[model samples]
Structure formats: C-alpha cells, structure tokens
Target chain A: MNCEEISELVYDYLNERLDADCAVSFTVHMDGCAECREQVSDLQHTWTGLADLPQEEPSSELKARFYSMLESQQVAAKPRPLATWFQNLAVFPLIPQGLAAGVLLFAGILIGAQIESGENVDELRREVRSLSQRVTLSLLQQDSVSERLRGVRFSYQSAVYDEEVIIALIDAVGYDKSVNVRLAAIDALKPYLSQQPVLNSMVTFLGKERSPLVQVSLIDALFGTNGGETLETLRVMSNDAQVIDSVREHVRTLLEESV
Target chain B: MNVTDVFSDNELMLRVRDGDNVRLGMLFERHHKKLFNFFLHTAGKRQVAEDLVQEVFVRMLKYKHTYRGESGFGPWMYRMARNVRSDQFRKRGNAPFDSANVETVELADERPAPAELLETDQSIGLLRTALAQLPIEKRELLIMARFELLKQDEIASLLDCSVATVKVRIHRAIKELSRIYHQITCEVRA
Candidate 1:
C-alpha cells in the first residue's frame, strides 16, 4: 500500500476491519515507512486513551426515571375504564345523549332530596362521593378536551379521594391527549398527593411525561415531598436530560431549597 | 444467564415496537452507558450528554415504528442518537465546549507506579482536551469508531455515507486529534 492508500485504510487497519491480504499489505507498508508507523502509533494511542476513558454510570436516578417512564407509559397505554366504557358504548348507536343527561339530572335531584331529608347522612355522603367519582370519570372520558378539563376541575372541587376518581385523574395526567387536561389533572391530583397511591402514580407519570408544562406542574405538585421515592424522582428530574431546561432548573431549585 | 440477556437488541426493540415497552428497560440497561459516553465525549458536557442519552431512548420509543428488523439495532439506535445530537446542536446554536464539565473517570486501583500513574492520567487529560477541541463532527466520528467501537459499516449506515467515506473521515479525525494532542502537549511543556 502506498502512503495515500495507507492513509485511507489506517482507521480500518487499526480497527482490524481490513481483510487479511489488505492487513498484511498495510502492515508491510507501515513497517517500511517511519512516518506511517508514527502516524499509526499516535492514532492507536489516542484510540486506546479514548477506550480507557471511564465509562460513566448514569446515576441510579436514570434507571429510576426510565423505569418510572416505562411504568407510566405502560399505565397510560392500558385501556382506561371510562375510555373503555365509552368505546363499548360506541357500539350502541341508539343511546340518546338527551336521555343520558336526563338520567344524570334526575340522579342529582334525588341526591339533593336525600341530603335535604338529613336521614342516613353517612349513606348519603357515600352516595354523593360515588356520584361525584362517576361524574369526574365520565367527564374525563368525554370526547371534548374542554369537558376533560372540566372533569379535572370537578375532581379537584369535589375532593373525592376514591380510588376510581384518583385513577381517572392519573389517567388524564398520563394518557390524556390534551396537555391542558393533563396539566389540570396534575393540579387536581395535588390535594390527594398525601395518599401514597396518588403520590406514587404522580411520580411515575413524571418519569416519561413529555410535556414541559405538565412536567413543571407535576414537579410543583411534588414539592415539599421529602419521601424517599419523591425525593429520588425530583433528583432524577432535576438532572434528567429529557426534561426541558426550565423544568430542570425548577426541579434543581426545589431540590436546593429542600436541602 | 437471564432469559432476557439472551434476547438481542433487535429482538428487544421489536418487542418494544409491538407494545411491550417494558422490554425497553432491558435495552436501556444494555446500552445506556455506552450511549451516555458517546454523548459525553461528543458534547463535552456531562449534563447535556446525560439528557441526550435520555432523548435518544425517548426517540426510540417515539420513532420505534421506523425501526426495520433487517437493520442492526445498534446502527438504528446510533442514527437516532445522531439526530438527537444534531437537534441539540441546532437548538443551542454553536454552544462552546465546557471542558470544566467533562467528567473525570475514576482510575482503577491497580497499584501502578506513581510516575506511571501520573503520566497515564496526564495523557488521558490531554487527550480529552484535544478531543474537546476537535470539530464536533470529527470528535463524534472518533468517539463512535473508537470508544463506542461501532464498525465502519455501521457508522457508514448511521451517517448515510459509504464505508470508504467513513474510513477517510475516521482517518482525518484521528490525524487532526493527534495533531491537536501534540500541539497541546508542546504548549503545556513550554
């Protein structure tokens, strides 16, 4: 191999990508050429130095964040109860919207009367909570984004900590197609964050959550949480590469203040 | 051996594409460090490199449908990584390398002679500085070819160029790096 040919083949030669005959030719040329030998040696040294550079382990936070994202994404990918209901309902073309509205209105009136009567107050409260949960879930599953936003608002107003309602809100945060709804859902879930399930779900959602607006809100919701999981989630978010700069800075600030 | 360890990256990615996203964690575990270093060397900023690694995985999920079973998963992943790095560059508009932010690897406690250890550390440091000084494209080429150990054809496919072109670029990049390293050494010595 000539000097020009050696130049073109040196990288392959160093990498052992050269065929046997070519390798022999290249080695023979380098053996005869001091300049080529020096060049190859320098390249090899640099290459070896680079190989010797430490392979950094991304903090446990990366694994935490990744698994959290994967979990959250899996959660989001699951068929939501209310959504599935709507999908099943789609098959029944004869279901009247007006009739559905009438049924809800009548139920509201019945619940109001039960409250007015003031008997079996505990039962009435249970019934009210159930109704509120259903309303939130149904609104969250609505075709209209605004309706879903309203559902998030209703969940916050009702302060229903029912597992069903919380799951719906979590779904909205993770799976809602609209960022506005998702942001609102994060806010709605704030009041329930004291509940471990709610806290855990929110932290997981923050793992792979893409919307900067939603991420900031979730981070805000998670502020003041010094629990092991929340702290770790916040730490990961603060250093997370996928997080937007503003959100990362916000988390970093939160983390600093917490310290 | 764990059953998962036996699955190839392409197989795991195929699972990921077909709605088994949890399998992605396996792939992440397998490749995140290498990807991290690739970004770290190329960007010369630890935090940015970290974020780029995450971005690449996120893109893998986002664009998983684009993955073809016929192509090697390494090249596919690196191609996405290249795009992510390019996007970052475009977004930052020629951000300067932050040498101070480059992470120092902890040397193994092999009990080498003190002078030899110091020389090794100094050479590594000088090489890193020279690497940071190279053009981003050259730096990336060297990192992929050397550090990441991506085959030339893999790089060629990743960069959408011929194997010959990739080889020539790798040669030039190493030469440039060597020149820069020697220049820095001279400056330090003087």
Candidate 2:
C-alpha cells in the first residue's frame, strides 16, 4: 500500500473493516511512512475527541410533548359515530298522528296494488338496488362512525355487490377510524372473499391493520378464501414480531387447527 | 428478551407506516438522544436542537409511507434529520453555520508540540469550539461518522452520495477539524 492507497483505505483500517492482507499491508506502509502515520494518528485523535463531547439530555418536556401530540393526532383521526346524529334527530317533534297514518295508508295501497300486478317487479328490484347502492355509498362517506357502520350494514343487506360498493367497503376495512366499522366492513366482505379484488384488498389490509380485533376478524373472513395463500399469509403474520401476542397466538391456533 | 427488544427500528417504522403509529414512541425512545446530540452539535443551541429533533419525528410520521426499508432505519432517519435542519436554516434566511456563533482563532506559525490535548477536559472544550468553526457540511460529516457511529455507506446513503465520496469528505473533514483544533489550542496558549 502506497501513501495514496493508505489515504484511501485509512478510514477502513481505522474502522477495522480492511481484510487481513490489506490491514497488514496498511500497517507495513504506515510503519515505513512517517507522514501517513502522523496523518492517521491525528485523524484518530480527532475522532476520539469528538466522542468526548458531552451528550446533552433533552428536557423531559420533549417526551411529554411528543406523546401528547401523538395522542391528539390519534384522537383527531378518529371518525365520529353516526348514532349521535340519529339521537339529535330524535328530539324533533313527531309528525301529526292522522297525517302520518294517511300517508302510510296511501303508500301501502299503492305498493300493495303494484305487488299484486307484479308486472314491474324486476324493475322495482333494480330501482331498490340502485337506491340502496346510492344510500350505501353516501352513508359510507359520512363523518359519523355510526353512519359508516350503517353503510357497511346497508352494503351487505342491499346485495348490491357493485364495484363501487366493494371499493367503498374495502376502503372502510382499511382506513376507517372506528374499529366497529372496520369489523363490520370485514363481515360485509366475507361473502365476497371469493372475488379477486375483495380477496386481494382483504389480504393487503390484513397486513396493514394494527388492531388485533380487526386483524382477527380479517383472518376469520379470509380463512378459507384461497386456502394456500391465506395459510401462507397467516403463517407469516403468526411469526411477525410486530404483531401483538394475542393476534399471533390466534393465528398460530388457526394454523395448528388447519394442520 | 423483552418484547420491545424483539422489534427492530425498521419493523417499528414499518408499523408506524402501516397505521400502528403509536409504535413511533419506540423509535423515538431509541433514537431521540443521539439525534438530539447530533442536532445540538450542528445547530449549537439546546433549544434549537430540541425543536429540530421534534420536527424530524413529525416528518417521519408525515412521510412514514415513503419509508421502504431499502436502507436501515438509521440512515433513512438521518436523511430526514438533514432535511429538517436544512429547511430550518432556509426558513430562518441564514446559512447553516452562523459566523456570529463561531469564535475567530488565529492559526499558529508552527505546530504546537503534540501535547496530550485530546486527554484534557479543557482541550475537549477547545475541540468543540474547533468543531463549531468548521463548515456546516464537513462538521455534519464528522459528527455522523464519529459521534453517531454511522458507517461510510450509511452516511453516503444519507447524503445521497457514494461511499467513496463520503470517505473523501470524511477524511477532508477530519483534517480540517484537526487544523482548527490546533489553531484553537494555539489561541488558548497565547
């Protein structure tokens, strides 16, 4: 090793990363070269001096502030439950008894005759499905957690398994701030697990979800969809150290049962 | 082994990205002290260093999705810290190294007899003053390499340069630091 080579490998030598032959060569070169030896020694001293600089401990307020900010952000991200909106609406004055009965009677006669004729039954079903889809999509977008929960319930009940509704429910499963809504969305998606998009979304969301309740529900929902892939995902998740113990244990139990 | 010990920085960061954002507490616990010291050495004020450390963590959360685990979490995090420091300096409309904070020291006509400077507390103080006098980029390189114990390749990744470039810069940085340390030592002796 020449002086230039020593300059190039000096850091490596200092860090002890140079191999045995190169290290020996470096030592031999340094022994013979006073200039290289002084330079290396000076650099080494500077490096050591830097380590002597006192490490200042940050104030306790830093930790307190960080955790408080985290808590606030988590709280802000939570979606409000929709049930509150219904409770507010319940305080409104009731409709007049006679007027309510009259409207109900008129609607009953109109719907009764339509069903009796049965000519537009398929058209009516389509209309109802379209309306339900609209309602489900709208409710899912609401700010109230309960309303989103209703949307998830509406999604499955309407049997309106369109691309838009599936996407909405998939989003709820992945991004909903409320655990109840996410759990409900997972349940709504259970029957559709055989579908590629729904299955893929669930599998992807399963990896991203941190809540043990939601994770366990997702695992249950995905249990038999594509047994091989599901088992593999479960097995990987079962061993994941990031996963909470309860969820991992649940996964392990399921894997053992499958065995 | 403790449960938390089982979780690596990357794993904790990945969890943060995946909506287990509270896991960032663990990352913060592991890195905040070293990061605080890095900022203190670079920024030269305790308050400013604390603010920078806070900003880095906030940015980590904001940009959590961008963490791909391609590099170890240390390099990725220090990269963010560098940006936070740069942005702060930019916002303040000042250079990263404030000349006002650096005390001028005259270079000696000749090298002082190699006293055991590195061994004394007063010499350590002078060394710190020498460090503060270095160009900001070179000071940062030395801090990361020596204090933070970041490897050459890791520093390269953080600086978006190659390992060879990092090596050259580090060598030059240490040489500059040594020159300044000697100058300060002479100033003190005079």
Candidate 3:
C-alpha cells in the first residue's frame, strides 16, 4: 500500500494481471491514497490512448502498385522457351467448357438429323485422340527437364487416384535432374510427409545431406514426424546457424517437454 | 461476421484459397485499417507501419499454400503477422533486451497534466512514446494484446511461447508501459 508497492501494482491492477491477494491489497491501498489513485487513473488513461491509436490504411494507388509489383515479379520468373510451351498447354485448363460446347453442338446436330459422312465421323474421333496424343507428347518433349518434372508434379498433386503421383514426388526427391525442380517437388510433397515411406526417406537423406536446400526441405518434412528423435537431428544441425533458429524453436519445445 | 458469415475473415481466407480476388479485396477492406494501425502504434511511424502491413500481406500471399485448415483462420493470419514483425527487428540487427531494463516499473508521475485535464483525455503522445521505448518483444506482445485483443493463450501461440511466459511478458510489458507513461509526463512538466 506504500507509494512504491502501490505504484508498481498500478499497471497489474489495470490489466487484471495481479494475483487475488495482491489485487485486494492494491485495491485497499488505492482506496485511501489520492496519489496512488491518480497513478492508476493515469495508467488506465495511457492504456486507452494506446488502444485508440489508428491503423494505417494503404491508399488505392499503393495497393495497385504492390499488385503490379507482384505480377511483374511473377512475370520475371517466366521460363524460357518453356514459357512458350506453357502458352500452348495453358489453354488446356478451359478444355472442359470447350468439350461441353462441342457435346452440345453434336447433340443438336444428331437430334436434328443433320447426317454427316461416315468418314467425317471417324475423322472426328481420330482428331480427338490425336489432340490428346499431342498434349501428352508436348509435355514429354519439353526442352527443360524441370518443365517435364512440373508436368509430373501437376499429375501428382492433382491426380491423387494415380499411384504414380506420390511415387513421382518421392522419385523427384532423389532422381530429378534439375535441382530447382527437385526442390519444388520436395517442398510440395511436404503436405504428405506423414506417409511412412516419405518420412523414412527424408530422415535417411537428412542424416548426411550436404545440400542446404535439400536439408531445408527435409527439416520441413520432419515436422510431421512429431517426436524427440527429429528434434535431436535438428539440434545437432544447429551449427548451420542459417536454419538453426527455425530448427531450434521446434527443438526448444521438444527439449522442454523432455526435461 | 460470425466466423462463417460471408463477410467474416475466415470466409475471406477461404475465398483467397479458392482464388476469389473479390473476397480477398473484402479481406483487405476489413483488416487493412486495423492491421495498419497495429504497426503504426507499435512502430510509431506511418511509413514503417504501412510498409510492414504491406509486407505482411505480401508474405501472406507468398505462403498462402502453407495455411493448414486445423486452426481458426484469424489466429493463423495474425501469427503470420507476428512473425513478419519480429523478422523486421531481427533484420535491423537489434539484439535482445537487457533483463535489468525489465525487472521493475519506474515511478515518477501520478499528477495529471493540464493538456489531459482540459480535455478529460490523456495526451496520446505520452503513451506512443512510452510504447516505442519498450523492448521489441515486450512492445510486440503489448501491441498485439492491445490491438488484436487476443487472450494470453492465443498470444502464446502467436509468439510461440508458453502461456505462462506470455502472462509474465505481458504483466511486465504493462508495468513497463505505466512506468514509461509516468516518465513522459514528468519530462513534459519539467
């Protein structure tokens, strides 16, 4: 209740952070002391001002500028002749609607009895399968190995029904010819690292992986493993200092639980 | 909105995940002002605050794919914000605070200043200055607690600290605030 103790309690009292006994004592002290009461009021008022401070709003121009910046940065990363090939294959995303339109046209023609030559009918089927072949062939024919790997990745994340998808992801980890593509594939597959084989392979590689980028991906994969053994590896690798903090924080929580 | 409402933050995040730019637009409309102010209060500079908020959203976009659906979306977004903020301090090469500066609150003021008494409102400058002088960790916790209004457990998760540690830090932070407030008032009067 004296000036020093009461003043110290002023903040905790305002925040409701003091223990019950200390709160009771602080309340009693404030009840009789004019100076202490003023201190409490000032602290409360200061808190109110701090609370009322306004947020910064980005103006319209800034938002547009930032968006343009992002788009330009993405544009800058556009791959070489590979980007041109994508320009060709990119239209494939709209194929469902195109196919639907074609189906509607075919149904109308058939219902109206607008008969075509039998050769024309066979040629249409041939054309459709031919288009499918070219699409698959174009993916295989990409000049950059990474572009083909991306096609594999596309199949991996999107076509889960295919057994080859996850297998491609794992195979990319150790086999992809391009480092960057391998890095992307490994990072992307981190979502499924809990899969026992993925965990087993990542840990096996993490033990002696010299490439920091691959080690980084393995660290991300290790998170799904959930235990001290993984933490032990990260703690030992703390010498890298680069990824140490990222590793250490997880390790810190692990070490805390163990102790 | 209720967390599920069309206007809710979670809905906006879901929209962002689904590639709905208009919903992301609404997310900016809803949170931009509030988040921007959080940095303004914490950094005490509009440009820095604006840059930090912009960087937060940029990082948000960069890491959008990593957002797992397990937690409430608000905490996840703010946790991202907290990381970006701490990363700013680290990049500036400021080391951690000395514990001595943290052990106790300084006492110098209880008397009201004329500027405050006349309007029945305290000078915001005092509080802002006081907050700026606090250690980055303490300032971060207090700004997040005061602005985002997260409870101790949520703050703990956002800071990646224990709940007890959050409680201790926040208690110390508020005490530091009161101390800084008093010091500012004394300096102004003197």
**Which candidate ranks first by DockQ, i.e. highest?**
2
Model 2: residue B124 alpha-carbon error in angstroms: 0.7
Residue runs of model 3 more than 4 Å from their true location after superposition: A1-42, A54-58, A66-259, B1-4, B86-122, B149-151, B162-165
lDDT digits (tens) for residues A211-256 of candidate 1? 8888888888887666788888888888778888998999888888
Arranged by lDDT, best first: 2, 1, 3
Over A217-241, each residue of candidate 3 has an lDDT whose tens digit, in order, gives 6776685576556766766776556
Candidates 2 and 3 compared by TM-score, better number: 2
Q: Fraction of native Cα contacts kept in each candidate?
A: 0.61, 0.56, 0.30
Give the TM-score of chain B in candidate 1.
0.83
Model 2 lDDT tens row, B1-190: 1222335788878988998776776678678889988887788677788899999998888899899998889899998998999999899997775446764322211236365644476776788788888888898888888875477778888888999999888888888999989888888889
Candidate 2 residue A2 C-alpha distance from true site, Å: 1.5
Decide which is better by lDDT, 1 or 2.
2
> Comparing 2 and 3 by DockQ, which wins?
2
Off by over 4 Å in 2: A83-259, B1-5, B103-119
Calculate the i-RMS of every candidate, to one decimal place.
11.1, 11.5, 13.6
DockQ of each candidate, alpha-carbon based: 0.23, 0.24, 0.13
Q: iRMS value of model 3?
A: 13.6
